[model samples]
Target: MDAWLYNGKDADDVFGILGIRAEGSRSMNSRKLVVLDEYINLFNARYPSAATDSFIVLRDGFGGEADFARVLSMAKLRPESERMIANTSKYQGELFSKWMVEDMLEPKGVLSTVLEGGSYGTARSEDKLVVNHYNVFYKRRTREQ
Candidate 1:
């Protein structure tokens, strides 16, 4: 699972990162939906063997990034399916820790990802079995000048 961080401040920022731009009069949500659909379509074309539903989208309630991060880490997702999500929620401050990308369907054009948050699923050996769930957070990968 390759990790990418997008600066959610403007449409152009998103466009450059996702490789899609909105046409005349397209609302942000509409643009996002279009990107999501296109992304999924493109993704499906590459991985015919992986079932279609394996991909999931976690949209921010208000359409920003933080919410995107939250849903990205939800425990309900299947451990093996690849997920591609665009966070449209807002985030305050920065965050860090360990994240794992379990698989990469198409390593270049489009990527399908399996995320393991924080430490690997197991606790230190000889200790009681503890489910170490990694809390996912959005950290800025690029600092805009």
Candidate 2:
């Protein structure tokens, strides 16, 4: 099971660390957006990694399902440095949203992959970038009903 811990701080830090730039772009590709939206629904429907599931759901709430999904898709596709900035923005928005609603909840991890220097932030590592077994059990092993 791949994984990274986040304590909720630091833009450069991976895992559950809170970052600094949690408010950047919200716009993204429509097809990837659709894929991400479905991905979130799958996450919610499955009994996979409980830790990250709650975080993703909670983060979705902050930006609205659509907005969060866009950010998430972008983050998934973005390079590490770009993700550092983009995720920071998204995470910050979610935090503020939760605070304003007085929910006082936080996500477990902020999973992001490293990126090569490129424009669409499409650059990725040859190594597996997924941070948890959520990808394994849900995305690879499970069969669709």
Candidate 3:
């Protein structure tokens, strides 16, 4: 199975720590919509047989409310950065949830289950290491009738 990770910040630094090829994208608004489309293309290209499975590791901030709030409380970020984070978190959470229910759960969809987990790493600044939580959504072909 192929695996990919998504985050708002530059992912190359933490890719080794997470053991996945991370792709950085806004994951909100219409700015980086193509990122998701690219991901779908990559998935299809990697799993051309239609019977293979893939994994997408998403930052918990993309869906976890409590975790996002906790990060906001602890991180010393600028006002604009804080607002952006909050907005993106809210938007991505709703979008992801909808995709999970309407798309992933449908027949022959390319998703099986979303599993939650956490990882420890330092930010780009490298000031200090912190726990970065995430969700790993497994994508696979649904059973054929």
Among all candidates shown, the one with the greatest lDDT: 2
Candidate that beats the other on TM-score, 1 or 2, i.e. the better one: 2
Over 4 Å off, model 1: 1-16, 19-28, 50-55, 59-145
Q: Tell me how far candidate 2 lies from the true structure as C-alpha RMSD in angstroms.
A: 17.7
Q: What is the TM-score of each candidate against the true structure?
A: 0.22, 0.24, 0.23
Cα lDDT, all candidates: 0.28, 0.35, 0.33
The sequence of per-residue lDDT tens digits that candidate 1 reaches over residues 1-145 is 0122222223233344553232211222344545655544554555555423212232223233222333333312322222222222211111112222222122111111322223332423211111212222211322221
Candidate 3 residues lying further than 4 Å off, grouped into runs, are 1-37, 48-56, 60-92, 95-145
Candidate 2, backbone clash total:
21
- Residue 14: error of model 1 in Å? 8.9
Please write out the lDDT profile of model 3 over residues 41-77, one tens digit for every residue: 5555655654221112234423343333233223323
What does candidate 2 score on TM? 0.24
In candidate 2, residue 145 scores what lDDT? Answer: 27
